[model samples]
Target chain A: MLGLNNRDTRFFLIVIALTLFTPFLLQPFPEGSAMAQFNAGYPDLMQRFAIYGIFAIGFNILLGLTGYLSFGHAAFLGVGSYSAVWMFKLLSLNVIPGIILAVIVSGIFALIIGYISLRRSGIYFSILTLAFAQMSFNLAYSVLTPITNGETGLQIRLNDPRILDGEGASQYTNLFGLDMSSSFKLAMGDYVFTFNAGYYFCAIIAIAAFYLSLRIFRSPFGLMLRAVKSNQHRMNYTGLNTRPYTLAAFVISGMYAGLAGGLLAAMDPLAGAERMQWTASGEVVLMTILGGTGTLMGPILGAGFIKYFENIFSKINDNILHAWFSALPDGLEGFLVTIIHPFVGKGWHLTLGLVFMLVVIFLPGGLVEGGQRIKTMFSRKKNSDAASDVKPAE
Target chain B: MDAILLQTLNGLDKGAAYALIALGLTLIFGTLGVVNFAHGALFMIGSFCAVTLQRLLSISYTTIDPEKTDFLGNPAKIETPYIEGWFGPEIGAAIIDWSVPLAIIFAIPIMVTLGFIMERGLIKHFYNRPHADQILVTFGLAIVLQEIIKYYFGANPIPTPAPTAFKGSLDIGVMIGFDPNAIIYPIWRLIYFVFSLIVIGGIFAFLRFTTFGMVVRAGMADRETVGLLGINIDKRFTIMFGIAAAVAGLAGVMYTPINSPNYEFGMEFLVLSFVVVVVGGMGSLPGAVMAGFLLGILGSFASMNEVKQIFPGIDQIIIYLVAIIILLVRPRGLMGRKGVMEE
Candidate 1:
């Protein structure tokens, strides 16, 4: 089906289905309910889910398959955002040109950085990429102010030289006549679902990117990357140009980050220097690792989990906690709240840090490994149960 | 000449900070083969030691003062420190004034203990893991430590003042036959430079002269070989980790007055320090110090008005620019021994 093998075809179908139904799936609670705050179906966040999903998929191609952990991916992301914003400033509010420019610019940047950084491998490689990213960040926040708009970041002004913003056309991003922010509000009983033009747009692109990544993962080039990771010495002895392969992966991933950045700007017309910061890069890495580095579904899962936590979960406050445990005895609830206070709400960072540590230490392969472990355990239990039942009275 | 000298002096203080942090980083890396992303947090904690002592000493009781009023039109509730109440105002005030210096004595043990706990509790398990995994775990630890500090002390930069005695700048240029104030440098900065020198010299001497240091050096060179000789290299490495932590702590303690100790200061310094480490070479101790000073000096020079005229914000990226150039030209770094981490 669709030129993919049976398994891949199934995977594609699953992803398509998920992306199509995301609005309904994400909006679990009814509007006006207390749990409405937890709904991630809003345009802004849903757009992020798709955008970051694309980003992670690209990242996995390099880090997961090639085993070249680029710590400066956020640099590419920032570059993409800057380029997209510039495109908006000069050309039009149309996202196509902006996104294309983002990919091309970031791809060039990745090519240059990757060529230099890939000279060394392991920790040295990580450091080199980090240095490059830091330099870029410093430049964006300070030196490149004319272009990047300094620490305040670049934002669209009312009088931008957008050549395509004809006489009475809208200043906002659009696809032909369809507004990016335009959404359909479906009212069914108590639940209200938002079908946003922007979210769907991003979702389609993310799915396409995901499909491309899947193809790349299954391609012969991917096998060579795995080979490079598993045994570089033998690969060298056998005489293969590992550099080009790694560099290609790096550029591809950088372009993915760029696309993600462009989509972000498409959703909200702004670009900040902080987007280039190492922390942003680290977040992407964490997303990839947390989801399951090498797997297709893992990166998307990880990105969603993190974005959800950062956006929705972090907003849970003392009031929410109190409400949650209100059914318990007053004294017990108060004690529980106090005990749990330090790891939630504003203390979400502590939880994030601790969770990161736990994931890295315990589940090195990430959440997917945990899932696999559970599945195997259940299967083993069932098998044992079958054996026992088949046996006589024992 | 004086302007150059002033810049050099400016560089020295920053150089001292970079050197101290990088030195500890090298020590830990050399001894344990683990890249500690949380080392800067140790330095931050060291600075916080000064803050902690300041808070501890300034534990106060409110008393109504009829002589003065606060912001509102009421009798000022003057708070007298416990130290002032216990020991007369003069000595207590002196103690409070010298809190940063006093923090050195307070921070060392705490830092060492923290180091020990960090190693035994967390990093010890990661010895055999891939470098990426190690970096991730340490990065996580850094975040946890940062958030914890932020939780206790808000995100603002807390200015931990130096002693009043060392507040003024020394007219070293006039003493060297230049105009007065032409080459004036902060006294505390000079002290910090001298302190760094002493610390660096002391560490070198300890490694050269002492038996434990010798054994540790031997272990760093070849741990299995030292273990084969039944030296218990693990214990020595743990002690080395403690020493490294104390070194970073001392640096942080001294740096509080220079740069107000903020929760994010660790992260801010970490990138530069890590760059210093890389530019110095992965496991080479002297290289770290050399790179730190070299980068620091270059950075100061780049920040000059003349340089900024040529290329704005050059100073901000000078260290990174130098690092990239160096990494490209010499992958092993200035004094990095070949094949340590060349692959």
Candidate 2:
């Protein structure tokens, strides 16, 4: 319970330990083991987990703190991704410049949307954001085809001239002297530990973003934002213009989304307009809610949980299920697997829907509240036992 | 001028769909104050109603015929349904030909029951929750419903054909004393337009004339006060929800011939319908209907090849562009009543 105050530091330690040692833990299993196949310890998926974590964290700031539920935040992420990819195409492959450009472009886009949408509050605001996001998605798919590459998506071409490196060109760019596509591997006995350079890069950025969020959470500005959420009328009556605070929060979250989007493109230099679709926006909302909306750690945990499930569950073919079930009785194992089959594999979404329903119904405050409850129960049990001993002494 | 008329006709056909779905959305929002995200899924299930009825009608017994060699070189003896036994061959053939239109009668009650179960089982529990939670739960329900439809229907689009009689297009240009092939319009699309008008009119007539309609409208205005009078406003609201579901179902049934019934059809138009509802103002029936037509027309105009040359991507964004402008100018919408979504 006391560690809750320094939960961020504790979480940081946990992340570092896991990232450093996961390879050792992952290596003992055979190369073709199911655990190996499902290993998120692989850099590509881990990078995605961190990037999406940042995106969800940004969404939580708006939905959790301000109580302004946005069904359209994916537009910013899409904009960021597109811009990042374009940067790679037109300029040097250095993700630093690409990421900066993405943030700026996405920020400006958010400014216009926030300015207009902030005029409405509550559900109207939600609808307004959704409408705008939908429009952006449509435009990207069609009219912006030349720019966004529509459904086919935009990708890097090796034929392009590289002014930064000159003459002979490369399809991909390096990240501040390190190759974006490179991996770092360590070996111990029969075990192999492969660490993705990009994963570490994203991990660093996520840590910095997390700290920034913590600062925002503790500041007076954050306090005002929460006050506005609780009672906007009271804040208005007190002579505070709640619009600016909300707008600021909207912009900040929008930039965070841009950062995440840039990281995605940096890792893989392809951007599709579908990334900006309303469904993508809704995903972050689900992630934020599934974790613990207002809690800082919830979004990251939620992002990891969702991405892990999406990757792991989607890969569970009939063969994989049968492998696990073979130890049981012939008829019984087949029956059990058949019942669970539709809820995984291509049907992984069914399981996701069930989890979301349970979370909404039972754990309204999400996993953070569940954690608190467990902590409270243990403390109460110890206190009761101490009281019993005191009564005997008396 | 000819192009304009043709586009308007095209717009009206599309508008008919927007209006029907929006009308249902408005009715539910008016009475229950619950934004059911699963409404689109209901519309989808309604379209599948035709597919189901068609399957039911296709229960023909096959017999091997040595004399007849079909594509597979098998015997071709097909037995028709009981309807064929009752009606003569010509009339029965025609009736079977128009089964999609006939499915409308079957869809209404089925869709209504589906709506009722959904409201009572899932939506009722979410009545006191925040709009976001209601949205999340219903969205989940929508995904589940769509997946179920996908499982049954598979991923491909299944073409539900119009009857042979209405298969061709009409040359309205010649009727208007212009060139013959200038303004060609499909006969079935015209039927869809007329059918939507009748359905819309019937709903308006019922709401305006019937005692039950009056009670529902009263409930929408103030449920607490209506309940205080011992009228059981919640029950009426539930009925209103059923009617809304039926309205969407009818739209889907008629819509089958226009485009094939596909599992994703519901989501395809869901956003556009929501835009229509917002631009028309939430919970306002006339507003929904009006905005639906207006946006549909405007959207069609924006999507015209000529229009695209000028603005590039106006078609993709036309509905949203209209929505944004409306929200900015009249925060309550063009016809939205005050205090509907303010709380």
Candidate 3:
């Protein structure tokens, strides 16, 4: 059972199954159909879902467990990416070496930042982390141009000294000899499903990351972290130095973020300073909150939900809206289109903002809690019904 | 000396803006004990108020006149502003030219109403929630407000120029016994600095002299004690929120000519203003203003060529660097009162 309880084992298995069958599950609509435009079974989109899922999962470890909301995680992500691309340029196009270096570099980076930032707690901690990230971003964009390649971003070039791969050994990133972008397409009846190598690779790593997080969440350290979140002052009063524990959690989460960033570079072989921006940090926070911050499966669900909306909902234009509403009366159709227009296509962020607001206002625990509430409500109704039946019989 | 003075002068207008926004942020934090992320959006909306008024004033009717023939020998078409038709042509043109200043009047009521609604409708429910929740909800509101503006304004910065009188630069070096043209500053920038000073002075005088301001200050010091004294401090807090919104909005209204109002300007300023608020201490008004100007002036100094030669890219991160150092060293900020957001 992988050191998990029965319920947790089942949950782990469910996640594995979902990750494995995402291609088929996401491609429910038949090929060439209007609904097929919403199908998110392609290689590019699937890879993003898994990668961002890893990112959100990593973010949740620090924020959810220790309640230390660091708004600078993207700095680690950007550092990891830059390290990875450097590996690709200097070492080889192979992903393993690049990814390993990425994790190490970002781990060290996180250790330094976390050491400084964890000195303060609460909103001050948040501000400190934000400042560090902003400084990193500013430096990367200006002074650190030699390493980061400045505004144009760091990318692989043809004539660079790729020591391991020699000269001109396939510019694309690979795992050994297998190209990451290669995919196997299957068609049956009117349905088409793509089995992408990059997605599966990301999925495997995401699963491992999730398992590691699960272990961390159930360990004695996790209990200590929760204690820290609930009452750090009390922990200090008990003569327990909570700084090391929080710092450890911060570093671990940073490594997870680095691993995600490495995978991203492995898929694309490029790094940009924009990845370190505050808004990028905010996106991960959004995913964590929208999914149910402290829950196990919430971040992944939130990541997928958001990525889906960003890709599919934003593709629906006025032409598609007109086609869909063609059967309705002219005035009513026009009214509905006008009403729905702002929430879709280019205005997807508007919908995202509104949904995030509503979630914070009403569903603070997010989608996972909403599901739990519904389940409890149904069970309670059943219990009451059983009680009424016994009374009637009596 | 002249170079230093020029940089200081250059920093003044920007410092004025930062002070105004941070002042409002401090006011809301002190009165309501809520971390409002949407305060920057109020500032943005204020700038847009000027843009909106300018657009409204330029609404025109077209007429064809046979007296002036076109190149193709057809009657020429003339477009005239509705204001010009209502009043004389000269008066209407002047009104259109002075739209940016006139927007102060237009933006005040709108910003105040928006602030009241934000407090009573949304923020009122979150009074007892955690700071994280307040930050998240307000951040969401900020995004929503900016996105709504983007939808209307099409994501471009609209140019709202100042009146013709203040369009030129002023050479103050001659009057100050320096060489001619040693210090030439923009007239509008100087005007902005004076206006911000007046606004800051007015806020201080109101807080020092007025009964409402005194009661609000007492509530900020001890809310439970004020409530126990049979005073409706919540109503006064709501009014304070409106006033804070107006302060931010007026700053935005005046700032239109300097940077041109854009949807993303809210977010850009929000991050800097948050840093300013933190460096000033969370709930201290004078601290906010002083820190705002200090950081602003420091930023300009860092951007100077001499400083950049010593440390490249320092200007971009000077405020954040200072904030980090201060937060680590002092923790309470420059003028922070005890027991206010210490946790």
| lDDT (Cα, tens digit) per residue for candidate 1, span A1-394 | 8568987898799899999999999999999898898999888899999999999999999899978788899999999999999999998888899999999999999999999999989887888899899989999888789999998888888789999878777778887757899999999999988999999999999989998988888789888888988888899898877889989999999999999999998888899999999999999998999888888888999999999998987898999999989999999999999998888788888888899899999998888878877766676776966443331110
Model 1 Cα interface RMS deviation (Å): 1.1
Please state the error at residue A342 of candidate 2 in Å: 1.8
> What are the candidates' interface root-mean-square deviations?
1.1, 1.5, 0.9
Tens digits of per-residue lDDT, candidate 3, A114-134, equal 999999888888888989999
What is the Cα-based lDDT of residue A90 in candidate 3? 93
Residues A32-140 of candidate 2 have per-residue lDDT tens digits of 6656666656777778888998898888888888989888899999999999888887777888888999889999998899998888887778888998888888888
Off by over 4 Å in 1: A384-394, B65-76
lDDT values for all models: 0.90, 0.83, 0.91
What's the CA RMSD for each of the models?
Answer: 3.4, 4.1, 3.2
Expressed as tens digits, the lDDT of each residue in B1-343 for candidate 1 is 7788878888998998999999999999999999999999999999999999989999999899999988888999988999999999999999999999999999999999999999999999999998888889999999899999988998899999999999988989889899876887889999999999999999999998999989999999999999999889999899899999999999999999999998888887888999999899989999999988888888898989998999988887889888888888898888998989877
How big is the positional error of residue A203 in model 1, measured in Å on the Cα after superposition?
0.2
lDDT of 3 by residue, B1-343 (tens): 9989999999889889999999999999999999998989999999999999999999999999979998999899999999999988999999999999999999999999999999999999999998888888998998899999988898889999999989999998987989999999999999999999999999989888999989999999999999999999999999999999999999999999999989988777888888999999999999999998998899999999999999989988999999999988988888898877766
- lDDT score, candidate 3, position B318: 95
> DockQ, per-model, please?
0.79, 0.61, 0.82
Instruction: Tell me the docking grade of candidate 1.
Output: medium
